[model samples]
Target: MKKVALIASVAMVFSLSLNAWTLGKLGDFKFEKVNDNVYVMHGPVMMPNKENGGFMNNPALIESKNGLIVIDPGGNYNVGKNVLAEVEKVSKKPVIAIFNTHKHGDHWFANKNFQEKYPNVKIYALAYMIEQAKDNAAETWYGILGSLTGNLEGTKPFAFPNSSVDHKETVVVDGQTFIMRHPAAGHTDTDILIEHVNSKTLFLGDNLMKNRFGAFDESSSIFGNIQILENVIAKKDGYKDYKLYVPGHGPSGKLHETLDPFLNYMKIIIAGAQKAYKNGMESYEIKEEVYNNLKDYHKWDDIEGQMGKHLMKAYSEVEMRDF
Candidate 1:
């Protein structure tokens, strides 16, 4: 009798500890149900040196009558698992679709996990993203950088999208309409925008970030990104007063309100690049010259290094092309 009582007490303590662990970890995946059927999963902060926090960015979950739709599954499979666990707690509906914002690992690395779990669900992305991932399968500078920085353990092979949209496509599911618009080359060659018509929410992906400057690297075009922003702003009515804009890397906020700062930053970068290009400045020279001017901006601390890298790449790409 004494031995049985001791074992029972140990098991009870172990069970309580497990429950405490689950509750303690719940904060990491906290989500806000924005409306009747929509829940926005906020991305955690990216720890500068931590492997798991390298590319932490906002991913959204939309629960509709038809099923659940997830946007831009976080940076890796682990992050995706956390997100999935949280999602399951909120709704038992299977993930019917996953819309990848771009080809960046942060946005689409967990796509295969989603496929594995929800075998019947469709995975969607821009045709260009699929092509780029296939074309650059063996040579990804970002993947290499992540590995070096210890952001990732090693390159994990990905499963490309089976279905993709080249142009604007509308998908109606569960009494809600999602408009998927593939914008002209910004952030990446195949960036996509998702508009939840009923919720008046627009997931801008990396095209328009709230506080951070949108990155324009070798895969992106500065002029093109600016034009895309303009187009998004111009189509104000099309979005039904787009109240919430889900950025790929920051908190979701109002669309029109967040446009000015991003536009200003892009304009400044483009102007500086054009001037340097006309002056026949090399990429390194351009980087050195414009670094200070950009660093002086209000949110410079958040974007300086990343923007500097992007500007240099954009300069090289522009120099190699017309003009």
Candidate 2:
């Protein structure tokens, strides 16, 4: 992706001041600068709900020559609006694009809100995510989260990402090269990875968490997820000297150090679940067994809700030989 000289003109016109940033809070989270032009709003480990103000997933903002490019805006209107509020403080330029890493609500439904704010902006996603967003896959989440969030009135239904790209597709937006990758079937069947070539940053949408593993639905695969993480860790030669490894949740950090915890957590979870199955224990019983064995890791982040569900899923993932 060759950079256009005009893009530099566009960047120069906007005198964006980083010194006067909104350092207080965007709802309950803060917009943190992880790299030279990349800003990330790191959300809490808790699930998406009214209590957390719908700030459950990390939304990253990339400043480019043309305009801002938002990654995984969020699950609802409020979170997206909050992200936009922060964007307004940082850059006066309009948003040129929005990329959703997957079909998960906490990852992408905010497309609608972003559209209303920046009507001409393009929303990009994997073809699978676009298909899921149009069909019952997204509809089911509308119902699930509606109830989970106690029918949050302003939260809208899924707005499908219009521009769909295939695997290994390279997109040049605002003078930045974004290389997208699909790592088997992990996180979800439609998990899409975005590699910002300029920053050497990888925005892993739920494929790998930083300090803690979070709860997931039936579409997730522990085995496939392990493969994704292993590939990322091994490919440091390609993704050399990582400035930031952004996960869907948790604080961003160096790729290897950030990914090590999730890898170790999965190893212990899968092994303990397999042991529980051998002991003739049910999923519910296995949860207690696995939790007892891996109790130390429960302190990672939001384990009160994520640990039990992860153990159950790990047991099923192993039982079905889907690893």
Candidate 3:
């Protein structure tokens, strides 16, 4: 009886351990090999009701001949650690580079973790993002959320990138050419797009979300975001053969299917906001009117609250004279 009990206990412990390492959910991080050398590891999406639903989505991992390049390491250390472990499972080489598509915590908060693990790894980000991370107020606010969400590990004010690229730059990694382009400022001061030349894969961070939740609060200009979407639509026409397109918030896409709906929504909101601004409507009034108009637009129920919050921010920024 003692032997049976001991074996049973050991089995139970082993099972628990295995379950912990398994992927969490659809929004949780998962790994996929989109091409021969490129791999994408998507993080989980925390919803509003969930404790940390707004924390981190999935990150994308790209393997090149040079080494490994990870984009937006998620919001916490554990997410970064899990993604690193997944990469190691596939390749024995160290992660050579890390990229931040923007300055948002969910996208770039895990930089310190990756840097600590891979000391020689090169960190790449836009110049504006490096500056934005220095905002004490923003850092403190996000720090509180990170702590609440249990994502505060390695969450200190991060060091800026040793290498910065703006506008358009190209680097050859593992024989594959990656073109990093800052088409225009939309989601934030800087929104970057990474394109793998050979494979025709594009990694669009928060600038493009698969879900309609459409968080534009962090954006400096909602009109600028609309222009960015137009640019992407124009680019999509040229890359009809593109295989994979990864977003910051949801699953990947093949064509620019996700871009159209988002652009249309932005146009509608901007038109309404323009009328309100012309009519000398206060910021709050404009926000309310726009929210009511878009309240029932498509599947608004899924992300109305989050979208409303962003719309208010955008209305204030876009309509405010100083902004």
Candidate 4:
């Protein structure tokens, strides 16, 4: 009787612990219902660090009739555990599926926990994303996220996507319809923008951000991002006019407030790069000019840090087109 009582006591403690969980100084995070059955936990906008524990991107959820569908779980194992704990608060149903946005660890590394807990959960991502995850990207991001988060506990990459999704692919899970939209190369070559068709919500992934400036690495194309954003705003390519836009990082909002600002920022960067290219100036030479044009985004997170690289990338793309 004592042994059985002790087990019950331990279970009670574990449940209470999860309920009272706090992530660093960020406090308790719960999934805020954005639309009908759709919830989003907007994580910290700052760079990964010990304080933030590498939790930076927006992890979202869609509650269908029988189970839940998660988008971009989070950074690492423990973060994934915490995410699921928060998930339990919203719905007791099992997470039947997950969709990774791109190849970024911060967005998908948490697959470890989900795969561990729910062995049969079908994790989905772009084919390129799955390839990168199996290749060196997983280990590479492990080191990066570990160092950034000060090697926070259980920050390993044990699991990656098990299923591959493609552009315009319709995935119906538990009565919810998810439409995958692919760009040639936006935030990254592996980027996948998910459209939850029923609620009219489009998950822009890192292809769009609210008020934050993200890095455009070698695999990313400024021109590609601009074209995709233009098409989305114009509702081309059989895309629906979405009622809600959820960025990979930052808050979710309507078109003008969420996506337009970043689209305009991209335009300004490319235009500045164009002016520099026409004048026989280098990418670095146009930094100040582009920065000046981005006055509205000056206060955005990581602008000062990412502006130079963004200008360089935009200039390189412009030069390639001219030649």
> Each model's number of backbone clashes?
1, 0, 9, 0
- In candidate 1, position 116 carries an lDDT of 79
| Winner of 3 and 4 under TM-score | 4
Could you give me the TM-score of model 3 versus the true structure?
A: 0.79
Considering every candidate listed, which one attains the maximal lDDT?
A: 4
lDDT of 4 by residue, 1-323 (tens): 99999999999878866776577668767689998889999988777888878888999999999999999999987788888888988879999999999998889888888888899999999998899878977887788888878744675536789999988899999999999988889999999889999899999999998667778877899999988888888889766788899999999998878878889999999998999999999988878878887889988888989989888899889989978
Question: In order, what lDDT does every prediction score?
Answer: 0.68, 0.77, 0.66, 0.87
Which stretches of candidate 2 lie above 4 Å from their native place? 1-28, 211-213, 236-241
Residue 202, candidate 4: how far off, in angstroms?
0.5
Looking at model 4, the pairs that clash are: none
lDDT of 2 by residue, 85-110 (tens): 76777788888999999887777767
If the candidates were sorted by their TM-score against the true structure, best first, what order would they fall in? 4, 2, 1, 3
TM-score of each: 0.79, 0.85, 0.79, 0.92
Candidate 2 matches the true fold with a TM-score of 0.85
Give the clashing pairs for model 1: 66-174
Screening candidate 3 with a backbone cut-off below 3 angstroms (N, C-alpha, C), the clashing residue pairs are 27-44, 28-44, 42-58, 43-57, 43-58, 46-53, 47-53, 65-174, 66-174
Return the lDDT, model 2, position 71.
96
Q: Which is superior by TM-score, 1 or 3?
A: 1
